[model samples]
Structures are given as structure tokens and as C-alpha cells.
Target: MGKPTGFMDYSRQTAEAAAPRERIKNFNEFHIPLSKEEQQIQAARCMACGVPFCQSGMELMGMTSGCPLHNLVPEWNDLVYTGNWEQAYNRLAKTNNFPEFTSRVCPALCEAACTCGHYGDAVSVKENEHGIIENAYEQGFARPKPPKVRTGKKVAVIGSGPAGLAAADQLNKRGHQVTVYEREDRIGGLLMYGIPNMKLEKHVIDRKVNIMREEGVEFITGANVGKDVKTAKLLKEYDRIILACGAKNPRDIKAPGRDAKGIYFAVDFLSATTKSLLDSDLRDNKYISAKGKKVVIIGGGDTGNDCVGTSIRHGASSVTQLEMMPKAPDQRADNNPWPQWPKVCKTDYGQEEAIALFGHDPRMYQTTVKEFLKDKNGKLCGLITVKLENRQDEKTGRMVMAEAPGSEQKLEADLVLIAAGFLGTEKYVADAFGIALNERTNVKTEPESYETNVKHVFAAGDMRRGQSLVVWAIREGREVARAVDESLMGYTNLGA
Candidate 1:
């Protein structure tokens, strides 16, 4: 540890964010990072526990509680405290494929399991990572170093999101020729569009993609395998193929008048905004506009919050979010002990913006949309909502949602965005390749291995697992790379 008593000496401090009213003026990263000295103090707060759960990546209560990449948290924390930034970045990159992405977008599972947080505050592990990686980039420490040798084996990665990028990076470094195919116009599948620009600016992704390209990873955009390019062509051309396509099938809301013109899936809404922003700075007005409209988003998850923020920026008249589940407690309950993922209320950035602009919290817990109200033009004008209650099912003894008695209400909504969540990978892509799918519609692969029933064809990330975080996707990508290497060469030294 850099300072034995650093935990007691310094209090927890995170980077400050720009005020909501000010930040809503433009789509850009709003968090202001701490200075070097303040960040060092934050890093010093890491206690370096005897059993460091921060890097354990354990599963507790059906949720991850630590760094999924098993990042060397303590090691890098000490490095930050001691002013050894290069070493800090090296230690961080040893495990995580992209600290830049995680540092900004990850929910910071490490902090939930932090020992310091049991009583006081958790160390600023996420911001410390951000500091190290940004410093590395600024100091020229993070640079492309292409592999010196070539194995002459070719590998095809069928996606360019975090998972696909991680897999391609690892395989290329292992001296295999790797090419990533992206169906979208740009690379970074979900990273390119699913996520909005304010939370994680698109330039950050482009910068990393450029570096990976310099390291000899070929990225082909607008190439949809199994459609534009045949699956048989990939199977024959490449020695192996890995499917890292994320869960793109979005769950939809079924209700009366659902075919209204103003209603759209959250992904399509968010993607159009980003595409239009990048294409013409939103000048052409190709995206669904929330400007001067009353926006009602269905779902209270992160994506819903993103819609809240994006709408506010577009000058929406008002915004509200509906969540079927009950609001969680402000603090962990007795059943949710320390080291378990905390089930508590968290007001994220978008919600905060909503509150600032609307003068109240936008989320309505234990509520759901019952039907859409449409104008004569078949455009959505409002929605009917109903309160829900949790009750134990008589047959299965499982808790289920039931409508509350006499709690129906109607609210105005010019535009409705469904941020309910994703289902799984689309059927057409998997069907074209003749790949089997699990009950959840994810690509079927061996439990521990990424290999599918079809030899030399593998699946990873949300394609193998269900919908998950970006960090988990990166983990799957790295592990699957190791699996592919072992299968091809009959042995491998790649990290798991």
C-alpha cells in the first residue's frame, strides 16, 4: 500500500459533474475529472484489504459485486497514489481491454463490494482508473504495438462492439490475422449508437478503434454477414469464426393503439439521434424529435434514463418514466448484507436532469402503461397508465405484478419511447448460420467454453450470455479468445 493509513487520512471524493441545466445545452461528456493531487488522495483511500473483494468478480444474490475483468484494483490504486501513472496504466490494461469505456459507462460493481463501503465510503476505484488511463493517453504511454510475428491463421469476428473488439485485439496480439465485421455504417456496434453521446462521447470509441486498427485489426463496416455476405463464405474463408453480435432484439410494449406513429423502440430512437447527430449535427432533422413534445418513456432502467436526458437536451416540454417494479430501499436491507450487490435507490445523471427541469422525480414506481392514446392522424398523443402491486402467485409461489384496484390514470404524451430492454440476438443472423439458440434466444454454446455445436464456430458476449454490462461483454470476449487459441493451436498462453 502506498500509505498504510491512507484510508483513515483521506475521505472519499469523486469527480464533480456539470450542473444539469448547463450540461443539457449540448451532447458531450459532462463529468469534470479531478486534478492529479485530488485523484492521488482518492487512490490512497484504497485500503488494500487482506481479502480484496474489489477484484474478486464474485456473484452474490444474482448480481456481480466486483470488477468483472478481475482488474488489478489494489495494485493500480497504489500506483496512482505513488505517482507511477505508467505502471498504473500497465497494471490496469493487463486485465481490462478498455479502461476508457468501463471507467465512464460501467456501474462500478467494484465499489458495491468495497470493504471501505461497509461502514464509510468506498474508494474511488472507477475514477482512479479513469485518471490512470487518461494520463497514459496524454503522456503517450498508450500507443499501438503491433505483433512482431504472424501465425498466418485467420479469424473472423462477427461484430465490432466491445466484445468483438476485445476478441479481435487479443487474437491479433496472439499473431493471428483478425478481421471484425460490423453491420452498421460505423464500427462499435452498441457503443456506436445504442448508448447516447453525453454519457460516453463517440470520439472516445473512434480513438480506440483507430488504435486497434494501427495494431493490425481490420474492421469492415456496413458488412452484414449471413445477408450481404453469406455465412458459408465466412466458414470457408476463415479458419475460425466468432459471433460477438450483441442482444439487439428489443422487447416491445403490447398495448392498445401500439401502432401509433409517434411510438418507437428505444434503440431505434437513440440510434437515429446519434446517426443524425454524426451525419449532419441534427440539422437535417431525420431523427424522431422530442423538441417541444411531451415525452413519456416506458421503463425505469438505464436506457430509460438515457432517453430522459436526451429528450431534455432536445428541449422537451416534459418527461416521465414508468417502472413496473417497486422502488428499492434507500439503503441495503438486512437480507442484503455487505459484499453483496447493494439493492438500493440510485438517482442517475439523467434522472437528476429530469428532476432539475421538471421540479420532481420523473420515475413513477410500481406503474405501467396500459394503452396508447392516438390522435386522428394515428400519431400518439397520450397514454393510459395503471398502478401495479406485487403478489405471490398461488400456484408457483412466485411474486408477480397485478394491477392495483382503481388506480388507472391518463397522461399526455406526444412521443413514446420504449426502453423496456433487449430480448436477445435477432433470429435471422443465427438462422442463416444454422446455429442453435438457448431458450432465452441467445446463441447456444457449451457452458464453460465458447464453442458452439458447429465446430470452429463460437459465440460470446451477449450473443452467448443474455443481456449484460459492457464489462462482462469484454470478459467474455477475452475468455473466448483464449478458447479459440487453444482449439486452433492445441495449446495457448493467453490469459483467461
Candidate 2:
């Protein structure tokens, strides 16, 4: 441990975010990171417990507890405290493929399971991680180093999200020539378009991608495998193929007046805004505009909150979010103990902006859209919502959300965005490869395996495991790379 009493000596600290109203004027990262000196103080707060649950990546109560990557949290935190940032970056890179992305987007599951947090505030592990990576970049320690030898094996990675990128990075490091194919015009799948710019700037992705290119990982954008590119060609050309195409099918709301105009999927709406912002800074007016409209978003997940924030930035008159589940408690319940994923209410950036602008929270818990209201022109004018209550099923004896009678209400909504989440992998990609899918629609694979039923083909990430966090996707990528390597060379020494 860097300091035996460090946890007691220093309180928890993190990067500061801009005021909600002030930051809504533009789409840019708002967090002001702590200085190196200040970060060292925060890093010292890590107790480096004898049993470091912060890195355990285990499951508890049907939710992930710590970091899915199983990051060497204590080792790097000590390095940061001792003024060894280069070594900290090295230790971080040993497990996590992209600290830059996760440091910003991850929910800090490590902190949730931190020993210090059992009573007091958790050590700022995520900020320490961010500092190490950003400092590494400034010092040129993150430069690419191509492999010295070639195994003469070829691999094709479909999708360029975290999973595909991690897989390609690992395989390329193992001296295999790897090429990544992205269906979109850009490399990042969800990271590029699905996620808004304010949370993670695009230049960060480009920086890492450029380094991977220098390390001999070829990326082909606008190449939709299984559609534009033939599956047979890939099967014949490459020694193995890894499918990292994420879960692309968005779950839709089935309700009355579903065909009304001005309603769009959450990903489609977010992607349009990002593409337009990147292509011309919104000057071309080629994207969906929420300006001067009363927006209603379905689903109270991260995507929905992102829509709320994006709409506020676009000058929306008002915004509302509907969540079918009951509101989580402000504090952890007796059944919810330390080291488990905390089920609590969290007001994200978008809702914070809404509160600052509208003088109230935008979410309506235990509420769901019952029907869409349209005018004579077939444009979405409003929505009817109904309240829900928890009820126990007689057959299954499980709790379920059931509609409460006499609770329907209508609200003005010029634009509607569905952020209800995703179903599974798209049919075309699975059909083109002729791989079998499980009941959940994910590519079928044996438990604890990444290989598919088809020979010389494997699956990973959301394509293999449905909708999930980016950290989990990266782990799946690392594991899939190891599997592919073993198939290619009979044995493997690659890390998962």
C-alpha cells in the first residue's frame, strides 16, 4: 500500500463538471480533471485492501459488482500516488485495452465495490485511471508499437466497436495480420454515433484508432459484412472470422398510432445528430432537430438521458421521460449490501440540465406510454401514458409491472424518441454467416465459450451476449481473441 492510513488521511475527490445550464449551450466535454498533484492525493486514498473486491468482476444479485475487465486497480492507484504515471499506464494497459474510453463512459463499478466505500466515500479510482491515460498520451507513452514478427495468419473482425477493436488489437499484438470491417462510415459502432459527443469526444476514438493502424490493424469503414461484402469471400480469405457486430435491433413500443410521424428510434436519433455534428458542425441541418419542440422519450436508461441532454442542447422547449419501473430508493435498502451493484436513483447530466432549466425532474417513474396522439397531418402531437403498479404473477409467482386502472393521462409531445433498449443481433448478419442463434436471439455458443457452431467463426460482445456495458464487451473481445488464436496456432498465450 502507498500509505497505510491513506484512506483515512485523504477524502475522496473527482473531476468537476460544469454547471448544467452553462454547459447546455454547446456539445463538449464538461468535466475539469484534477491536476496531477491533486490526483495523487486521491489515488492515495485507495486502502489496497487484502481482498480487493474492486477488481473482482463478479456477479451479485443479478447485476455486475465490480469492473468487468478485472482491472489491476490497487497496483495502478499506488503507482499514481508514488508519482510513477508511466508505470501506472503500463499496469492499466496490461488488462484494459482502452482506458481512455472507459475512464469517461464506465459507471465506476470499481468504486461501488471499493472497501473504503463500505462506510466512507470510495477512492476515486476512475479519475486516477483517467489521469494516468491522459498523462500517458501527453508524454507519448501511448504510441503504437507494431509487432516484430508475423505468424502469417489472417483474421477478419466484423464491427469496430470496443469489442472488435480490442480483438483486433490483441490479435495484431500476437503477430497475426488482422483487418476490421465496420458497416458505418466511421470505425466506432456505438461509441461513434450511439453515444453523444459531450460524454466522449470523437477525437479520442480517432487517436486510438490511428495508433492501432500504425500497429498494423487495418480498418475498412462502410463495408457492411454479410450484405455488401460476401460472407463466402471472408470465409475463404481469412483463417478465422470474429463477429463483434453489436446488438443493433432496438426494442420498439407497440401502441396505438404507432405509424405516426415525428417518432424515431433512440439510436437513429442519436446517430443522426452525431453524424451531422461531425460532418458539418450542424451547419448543414441534415440531422433531426428537437429545437422548439416538446420532446417525450421512452425508457429511462442512459440513452434516454442522453436524448434529454441532446434535446436541451438543441434548444428544445421542454422534455419528459417515462420509466415503467418504480423509482429506486435514495439510499441502499437492507437487502442491498456493500459490494453489490447499488440500486439507487441517479440523476444524470440530461436530467440535471432539465431540472436546471425546467425547475423539476423530467422523469415520471411507474409510467409508460399507452398510445401516440396525432393530428390531421399525421404528425406526432401528443402521447397518452398510464400509471403502473407492481403485481405478483399467479403462475410464475414473480413481480411484474401491471397497468393501474383509471390512470391514463395525455401530454404534449411534438417529437418522440424510443430508448427502450435492444433485442439482439440483426437477422441479416446472423443469416449471412449461417450461425445459429439462441432463444434470446444472441449468437448461440456453449457456456464459457466464444466459438460459434460454424467452423472457423466466432462471436463476442453484444452480438454474443445481448445489450451490455462497454467494459463487458471489451472483456468478451479479449477472450474471443484468445479463442481464435488457439484455433489458429493450436495453443495461445494471449490474455483475456
Candidate 3:
């Protein structure tokens, strides 16, 4: 625990973000971290509550309430407060494999469930975590520690996202020979491209990947399994195969003129920009150009917001975001009590940039694209959008967003980005592996197990659990690693 009365004595403070306008000029991490001393002070604010829900990864009201990795938030906070940097890092590394990735991209469900946050500000757990990890890297504490004894059990992990990386790290730590396969040219599946650089710099991923490589984990990039690499070969070569390829099937927008030239999937647009940025610093003109063009993004989730920010960085003339759901309350609703994930409106960094540049919030609530308008040459020109209202479905007994009859509107749009989310794992990957898919299209596994119907083959992460947070994927990875270790060696001591 931290100082007994530190929550009362010290106020909560976090890293300051660079102004949106200034940061829009280049794609880089914009959050300036707090000094070591300031971070220690912030860590001191973790109150010694008898029950710390901040680390309790429980679901309440059908929403996750805290860190899915079940990170030892209070313990690490106390270590940070006591200036025990190395120990803090050790405690952090116990449960979560990639604190760097979580600290940057996580929504901080831990903070939302913090006891102190019930009445006042929550402890700066995420920032404190960031400080600890970054400081560990700065010091010599985070050096590679390859296992001395090799069990000679080879594990082939398909995909190099957080889940795959975590499984590879843990299994390797347990003396299993682990090899990671990535379809993309680089490691870090979504971490490398799905997320924009302004949120998480690519170097952060590379740094940890280098550490993994040094620790005896083998990584093969540009290996597209199912299509290029044969599953039967992997089955014959490796002792076990763990499918962590992630849910790569993007849900498409179906409407008239859907084949227009100027429309692109959000993932494709983001991936191209990042690939080009890494390859030639955007000098190659390899990405979809938003420069001097009007942009409209469908699906008002994180990906949609990312599109808004990316477009702004590309000097978009104007940007608009279509959201099918109504805007959430500015503050937590009475029904949405403490400890449950707050169902409130959050203006993320992307939206902030759009507002600062456009002088207005770009989101249109309860609106959806009715049709894509294209020119004679098959180029996207504009779009027809319709307002939606919540209506009760008679047979289903559920609320549905139905179109409002007289609320159609037309807007000029030079480009459209569909961020409508994913359905599940790609069919080709599943079919090639000879694995069954659940109703949701994710890899089918028995309840509370990573074992697939196929013997010696396992599944984890988004491929098994559907599209989810990076932290959840890491948790799955760790759990699957434990399962594989236990299966390989009659009994194992790896933490889940």
C-alpha cells in the first residue's frame, strides 16, 4: 500500500499532453511524461483501501471494471512511492507482459474502478506504470534474461500482436523454444499499424521486440500463414501450435455505390500510412491521400477517431464522423454507479485535434450513411446520411437503431473511411488450420480452455475471444502459455 493518507494529502496529477494544433504537424507520441519525483508523488496517492478494485478484473453490468491483466496496481504504486524502481518493475512484470503497450493504449479501466475515484480523483496508475516501465528501460534493469535451461518443446505462435508476443515471451521464459510468425513485414500486428503513431510510437514496439529477439525468441516476418505458410508443415515441425492471428476480418459497409474508388477500410488506410512512414517518412506517396479532401468516417469508435486524426495530419479540408449510437451522457449516469466502467462521453486525442482544427466537434450522433454517391467515373463524390432513433423490436425485445423516415441529408465527401469494426477471424486462416469457428466467427474452443477441436492445436487472443482490448489479449496469451506449458510438461509453474 502507499502512504496511508497520501490520497488526502496529494492531488492526482498525470502526464501533460502537447496541444492538439502543434502536435498535428507530425506523427509522434504527444504526451509529455512527469518527472520521476512528480511520478513518485503521484504514486503516493494510491490510498490503502482494504479492497482494491483497481486490480480486480471483474465484469459488472456486462462491462469490465478494472485491469484485465489483473495488474498489482496498489502494490506497484506503493513500490513506486517508496522509490523502489527495480522492485516496482518486477511486480509489474509479474502479471502483465507488455506494460509499455498497455500504459500507452489502455483506457485505464483500473482508474475507473479505483476506490478514490468514487468520490474524487483516481490514482495516476497508468502514468505511474508508464514511469516505472520507461525508467526500467532507461536503467539497466530491463535487460534480456534468456532461460538457461531449454525444455526443447517448440511452440509456433501465429501472429505477432500483443497476444502472440505475450505467449511467446512466457513460453520462452519457461525454456520452450518459441517462434512467432507475422504476416506483415514488421512485428506487432495491430500495435505496428492499427493504432496511429501519435498514440503509440512504432519505436516503442521495436524496442521490446529487440529485447524478445535477444531473449531467444525467434520471429519470422512477412509470413502469411494459411495462404503462404502451410499449417500442416507447422504441425509437423513444432510440438504445439497456438493460433493468435487476431480477428482480421473487417466488417464492410454495404450500400449503393460501395465500389467507389475513394472509399477504404480504416485498417488499410492506417496500415499504409504507418508502413510508408516507416519505409520513407511519407515521401513515397504510398498511402491514401486525404490532403485537401473532405473526409467522412463511419462508425464512431476508436478507429473512427483515429481516421479523424490521421486525416487532419494529412491536411484534410474537412472531416465528419458518423455514429449510429446516440451520444453518451457527459457525466456518468445514476444507473452507471462506481466501479463499473463509466458510460460517459470521452473526448479522446483524435477528437480533440479535430475540434481544435475545425472549431467544432466532428461527430454526428445517431447518424448512419444511407448510400455512397459516386461520379460517372466511379469516384466517390458525396454521401447520403440518415438520422436514426432507438425503437423496441417486438419479437427480440431489444432496442434497435431504426432509420428516421424524413431525416435524410446529403454531404459532400471526397473520401470515406469505414471503421465499422471486425466480424471475427479471417475464414482462410481458420479453414487452412482445419479449426472450427464459433457463432461469432472466432476460433472455437471449449469453455474456459484454449484447446481447439484439433488435437495439439490451441487458440488465444482475438482469434479465440473476438475483437477485444490489447490488455485482454495479453491476458489470454499468458493464460494460453500456462496451458501449453502444463500440457508440454506434466505440470508447470508459469503464471497466467
Residues 1-496, candidate 1: write the lDDT tens digits.
Answer: 7578888998888889999999999999999999999999899988888899999898887888888899989999999999999999999999988999999999999998889999989999999999999999899888998999999999999999899999999999899999999999999888889899998899999988999999999999999988998999999999999999999999999999999989999899899999999999999999989999999999988999999999999999999999999999999999999899999999999899999888999999999988999999998889999999988989999999999999999999989999999889888889988899999999998779899889899999998898999999999999999999998889988876
For each of the candidates, give the backbone clash count: 0, 0, 0
What is the C-alpha local distance difference test score of each model? 0.92, 0.95, 0.94
Measured against the true structure, the TM-scores of the candidates, in listed sequence, are 0.99, 0.99, 0.99
lDDT of 3 by residue, 308-356 (tens): 9999999999999999999999988999999999999988888999999
Instruction: Please list the Cα RMSD from the true structure of every candidate, rounded to 1 decimal place.
Output: 0.9, 0.7, 0.8
How does candidate 3 fare on TM-score? 0.99
What lDDT tens digits, residue by residue, belong to model 2 across residues 1-496?
A: 6688899888888899999989999999999999999999999888888999999999998988988899999999999999999999999999999999999999999999999999989999999999999999999999999999999999999999999999999999999999999999999899999999999999999999999999999999999898899999999999999999999999999999988999999999999999999999999999899999999999999999999999999999999999999999999999999999989999999999999999999999999999999999999999999999999988999999999999999999999999999999998999999999999999999999999999999999999999999999999999999999999999999987
Give every collision pair in model 2: none
| lDDT of candidate 3 at residue 368, scale 0 to 100 | 92
Model 3: colliding residue pairs: none
| lDDT value for model 3 | 0.94
Q: List candidate 3 stretches off by more than 4 Å.
A: none
RMSD of model 2 against the true structure: 0.7
